[model samples]
Target chain A: MWRKVLTFGVLVVFAASFLLAAPVTIHFWHAMNGPLGAMVQKLVSEFNQTHTNIVVKADYAGSYSETLSKTIAAVKGGNPPDLVQIYDIGTQMMIDSGVIVPIQKFIDQDKTFDVNTLIPQVRGYYTVGGKLYSMPFNSSNPVIYYNKTLFEKAGLNPNDPPTTWEGFKEVAKKLTVKNADGKTVQYGFTSGLVGWFFEQYMAVQNALMFNNENGRAGRATKSAFDSPAGLRVFNFWNDMVQSGVMINGGPGWDNANGIFASQKAAMLLDSTSDVGMMLRQAKEGHFELGVMALPHPAGVPYGGVIIGGASIWMINTHNTMKEKAAWEFLKWLEQTEQQVQWSEGTGYFPINKNSLTKMMYQGFYAKHPQYLTTVFQLLMSNVTPATRGGLTGVFPKVRATIEQALSKTFDHAMTPAQALKWAQDQADSAIAEYNSLY
Target chain B: MPRKYVPYVLLIPTFVIIGLFIYYPAVMTFQKALYKISPFGNRSFFVGLRNFENLFNSPSYSQEAFTTLIFVVASIAIGLTISLLFSLLLNEKVPGVGIFRTIVFSPYAVSPAIAGTLWSFLLNPVVGYVSYTLLRIFGIHSEWLTSYPLALIAVMVATIWQNLGFNIIFFLSGLQGIPNSYYEAAKIDGAGAVTRFFKITLPLLSPITFYLAIMDVVFTMFTSFGIIDIMTQGGPGNTTTTLIYRLYRDGFIYFNSGMASAESIVLILVMAVITFIYFKFVQRTVHYR
Candidate 1:
């Protein structure tokens, strides 16, 4: 009887070991939706098929903000996934959460990988204390998407779009048309007045969005939206909205997309990721779409824009093999081939320069000259600490306040200076409160 | 098992479930409100009452409080009056009464999130049918989701529309529950329609009115979260922000857990006091057999 029991126990142990030795399945939670989601799934499946010893399962985790909140909750509940994709604004908070397996660790462990190959501005947003916290998976900057048909009708050059806000306003005023009934047939400018868009405006001036070197030298103690640059942004939006140049289409990405898609607006200031969608839609419409860098304030050197999309984060699950497997996935995702494929598929900037050398991408750019505009703009913008975007514990809230301030200006409830000052105070208190908690 | 033990055993599962989900979370909220906790759930230190103090001292707190009060009051006043009017109409023997009642009650079936999205499309200032028609004809669409008081009014309109169904059902039942003979007695006594409505119908329906009042206040506090999230996002300078939205923003969005917990406690206190006032004074005059 004892020998039989021993044989059964041995069999059970061998079975458990065999099960554990099988391919390791790692869960990746992301926020890719729509066509971009299909692209991600394709890449994920391709990776899974090629790698026989490992399997990566990707979960669509809603929008960027939703994914962050879910990831945080899962951490507290002790069931976090192996990896997540966090947006740029959540960098400081992600680092402070202390739940990340710094990409630097993986790079150091694998001597063949070099972190410096990452685009400068892309790297700047994820670096903390000289170490990259997350891998820059996808990056996109703001661009001016113009309706060339409307531009030609308005007697403006489609190729030479506005480079400054003043120029844009003039162009918008010219392009705005009314029917015989005195109704607005086409507004010159309309965009979702979101907090993220506000960040692009500040970044183009090469201005620090927050004090303390955009919170890279130390923690951000105050918001810099009350400065001259911020006031200018507010006044531009306010004046445009109050006049008929820019229509209040309401706030959010969907409304902005709607206004542009319906051809009610001549120009749209939105992200580069929107290029693919806009181009596809334009092909079916009567207009030719053109892309340009985000406009700057007149006379000030174009300080340029920062990357504003999501990045890949390796969640620290405290198991060495799992961490190593996640890193392998990350390295695979960062390959030049994958980067070029991602850029071509999603209109996101290729993080690795080697991807630009790919003949297929060059062919893609030649076929669609509009696609080259964002790449040229990104290369022209000098990477600086200020243009890299701010890192703060309450960046998302600070942005909400900025949106509130901007909204107040457009609503005629408060002047630009007053609203910005109020926003500065609100941001200060929020940061102070956040610092106290951490 | 013995019969006495069976009752306890059956109830044990419910009590355990409630204890884990409800009582445990509530106690943790109260305890966490007194301490400073980071986003990662680390207990840095305790500062009792300071969370509450800081909340009141903060610049946006008063505005937030006023905003929440205005939202609740506006939603209740508008929702209650419209609901009562609809209920009165629904109670009458008008033609197609069933269809009218069904139409009034259908919004209750729509989730807040879906309703919010629908309203967002309807009120979109540029391409929306409502806004486009008004703008093309009148040269102004009020920028329903962009302008200040207009945005608040827009959200309130959605809130009232959502609660109107629940309010109508309750008031309809309340109207039905009253003995028809009372109305007949008033009619025989030469009481006019307005007088009978004021004197007999209003007084007899006090209990239902009271119940709806409490439910509306609670709904304004909690359920409007979805509409606010989808439609306005508490924007146009915090005109649409309420206590619950503030709690969500401070705690989850900003990661100020201590402040969020304190605000949660204050919201509970406010709801409790409102309830207390309703029960102590308002319920006394309610008619019951």
Candidate 2:
């Protein structure tokens, strides 16, 4: 009887040990902050709750640029997180880093996951040589956010926003309000000195910013933005600034948004990711907001705005268990439900094509028509190489060069042609230097 | 250990720290300046000073260097002058002098970035209180940050304001350390305030002034990154892009670590020359007593 009792106790102890085994932990570094960060935490906790065998640790790693730098430093220090979120412009650089395991590898191995389900424009930006390196998380494009009340006050139709650059200028001129003292009290349009907008304008004109089909066909050897298409965009922008229809909103997104929110500017060109915040700001400002697609230059076939924002990249740790666990979390994040949740929580539209078909999103779109405007813009965009966005390791530097060109043009220190030429030269040299090293 | 070795043994920790943190990084940066390094530092090849050559050939580098010189000289000259004036005034035996002293020194307690943020808000074109007041009263739309010379001036003004407290603290202490007997003797000699200031006070405070000048030069060169970044982001067509700001752009934003390292080496050399000149020529004017 004593021997039987000992065997029973040993069996119970063995069962307890097996039941209490440690779960695999996945480290995730992201750039999301504020309400979006809270949503990320909520999703992580929910995932942790349902998946008893896996625990995901999420960390807010500052801004997109900071996160990329921190991730690279961590990788060099031999303690990188399993996954990291990097901005759209960092795609080529991250790909060239040779540190990330392409998400396509897991997609190919996982028979249940469908790669084609992602929105083409969103997926195309992250795809290199027909393979997606990262999972599209937050995708956005430039959109015109106008104050409808201001439009009406300016004797313009609130529903019919301009679709062409010339028409945009004409409307902007009309919207500009001046006092009896010859002081302009309200400017018509304002945008930050952001190079992303320049790139979008180029895209809308079906213009390649760099050679080799915007670097998608191959590595871009030189900047192609000094062409007529580039000059047209620059000339239009310069004319607006020169004519005093638009105000220089300075160098950051917040400044332009402030100009609009304070009723100092009638329209603002900004990322669609700001839709939720813009809506709230409009409500606070007691003005009705209207959203529209970015205007294209006249007599040009509209290409479309390139996909902006960031994607989640899986770091190569050479540990299959950690890799698989991270991939599982990524796949879970791409689910229609989670996509809908993310879209509603943040202004970034869902990249999963199936999410649009869901009844939940249908109802959500019906209630908030402004959100559908960005979705329609994305759907209408042509999936050409120009719209696929430029792929170069020196994209950030190229963008800075473009911004400098814009600044020179705006300051009237250089004409549009001269500024673009300067930018082209600087960008080409930067690209050459980066290509040589990479 | 021998008796001589005892001191060396005690100094080991300091040597180790300095070697690890300062000398090691300096050596690494010098080595990196000769190579073309990938952004992640995974791959590199010796380029042998090509980065420095490229920088020298670039127009932007010269422009930035010029801007850096103007910023350093202007900030130091104007900053020191205003700080000396405020310190002298606060040095008077007036009522509420302690409060004035605290107010003058308060900005020194604030970080450069915080000072920059505060100043940016005050100087913002559309909604800034200063701009709004100017528009309302004078009808002048001063685009403080987006315009050319104004952008540089705005950055300088903010930097000077932020650094004023530091200079004031030093000048105030230096003033306090001045023996009252010297001023009494000057008064007896029938020396006017200005004459006394130029002759006695200025020369006697030369040591502190010289020290402050060197510190201010270094501060304006290296520590003005925050103010420039916040106010203008070295913008309006590179009108305000200083060498330090350029270095940050290359190293952090653009990920041109090799070029950044090269720029850093150049910066170190520039500072060394400046300090050398200060000690060689300016030190002779400094009076200890």
Candidate 3:
């Protein structure tokens, strides 16, 4: 018994020593929870299976905000993860924080890396002062999701969905059902109301949401949401709520999606990224659904919606070899085949234009033509600096103000003018405050 | 045991841990606060007191500081009061006490992220069960998280609900530890329930109360990060942006490490000072055996 125990103890020590000598582990922190979280783990497993020298450990770090906080804390503590997926709005902040080495330089160093073929809009957001800082991992935008059954139930043609705001309003009013006491039984339209959605909405309307090339040019520009077109959009949204044509979908995107999925609301404006999950839920509920471009205001420019999604930055928290490994991973991620697989699996628009030509994407589109809108939105986007996206040093703060403004407008707590004025004032102050730091 | 060196041996592990985890970071944060670092890991020349000066001059910091204070104070005060009241009621021979206890303590066991996610879903303006019930019952419809003035209140409500259970458990333990002889003595002296509670119960639970208050204050300030981060994100016009969240944003979001480090040092100092003040001023008011 003593000899057997000694043998086991010796084996355990040998295993421990082997593990200690294993290749350097690169930690990746992310906020992809639920199904996507599992999918990410699978991706890491596949990566580990292929790569023998590098072991990538995936840590689930709650929501996007939580993940950001954790990454920052780690960076501050001088023990940051080798890789982290940061949301687009935080790109500027992350770029300014010198810890991240631009992956473009590394890609440039690698003769095989063909980053030039990257989807322009995807790469555009991460490029700071004409240099790319991060790689676009997930690119999504708000799209109009409608319940075909609800459209039919309201005696409207299921195939014909609204494309313009006026048309949307008329259809929404018609589709809204009232109970015996005149209370709403089924709402016509709802959306995840926040600045990001409004920003996309404004982009669709060809309105200048902010100045300084919408933060792509430089950080000195102030927000231009107080423009005439901006006021009109806010007023239009307010009117929809006041007329009971729309309901407060929820404070954010997920809530809005829930209301529509539950059939409590007929139409939803949510991220195209949620398409896969929504489709699964719809299949389970046995509800037929339709997808359409987000409704644009009448007579607006044909400038398409802004790209909204997350990207991965190569943080300089590692040594040269680790940096090279990260670049290799990023390059692999951007490859047409990989992009096609990722986009098809996640319902996010591929960040590589070449990926769209892949048979996998074509096959998916052939099965569900609805999948084409994700690519169409990208192609139709106005290539001008302003229409590309909104930028500001304090976009996170500005987003909060817009949410507050919209909340009050929707809740009947204040008028559109009042809310806009407050938001404008708040945003102006935030911009000024953020500018002072430099 | 080796009696001569026993104390030193025992003290070594604790001192090493405290040094590595707490003291070392505190000292490094103070050092980094003086130097401005760029996004490329480029170190800037030391700008003595400039980050603090910038913090004071900025309206965002002012707003964040005030919000943090309000959030910490309100959450702790309201959470403790509700728990205390519930504990008093729970002390009685109530039906299904164990079930009630479990229900109250359930939120405590939940991770803060889960708690935030669940409560955010519950408090959503539309399709949220809580919101639907509240509106139907009271004819009140408000965006709990998005409304500017009330956003803080909404955050506090979610925070208190998730925390009240844990506080109740603490208070319950404290209440049970109070000997029955004291209550029996109070009854003999013709003390009514209110007097007994105010004079005897409250006073006797003072030590636990002190500890809970300190722990709650520190925990609420430093840790609520998850709840606020997930729920409000210091949003709806920075109404819920606490000091920690702002520190996070400035440091991580913008990569303003110098500012973040400066803010961290300030945060630590504020926490230490407040704790010292509480122990000195408030701790004195409490009675303990």
Q: Pick the candidate with the highest lDDT.
A: 2
Stretches of candidate 1 above 4 Å error?
A1-13, A179-183, A283-285, A359-362, A436-438, B92-96, B179-192, B278-285
List the pairs of residues colliding in candidate 1: none
Q: Which residue pairs in candidate 3 collide?
A: A97-B39, A98-B38, A98-B39, A98-B40, A98-B41, A99-B39, A214-A391
lDDT of 2 by residue, B185-204 (tens): 98999999999999988887
Q: Which prediction has the highest TM-score against the true structure?
A: 2
What TM-score results for chain B in every one of the models? 0.93, 0.96, 0.91
lDDT, model 2, position A225: 95
Candidate 2 Cα outliers beyond 4 Å, as residue runs: A1-20, A359-362, B1-4, B278-285
Classify candidate 1 by CAPRI docking class: medium
**Model 2: residue A319 alpha-carbon error in angstroms:** 0.5
Cα lDDT tens digits for candidate 1, A33-89: 998999999889989998877899999998888898899889999999998998888
For model 1, what is the alpha-carbon lDDT of residue A184?
78
What ranking of all candidate models by lDDT puts the best one first? 2, 1, 3
Q: Looking at model 1 chain A, which ten-residue stretch has the lowest summed lDDT?
A: A353-362
Model 1 lDDT at residue B278: 86
For model 2, residues A264-370, the per-residue Cα lDDT tens digits are 99999999999999999999999999998999978999898899999999999999888998999999999998988888899999898889778344698888888
Better of 1 and 2 by lDDT: 2
What is the DockQ score of candidate 2, to 2 decimals? 0.64
Indicate the worst ten consecutive residues by lDDT in candidate 2 chain B.
B280-289
DockQ scores for all predicted structures: 0.56, 0.64, 0.22
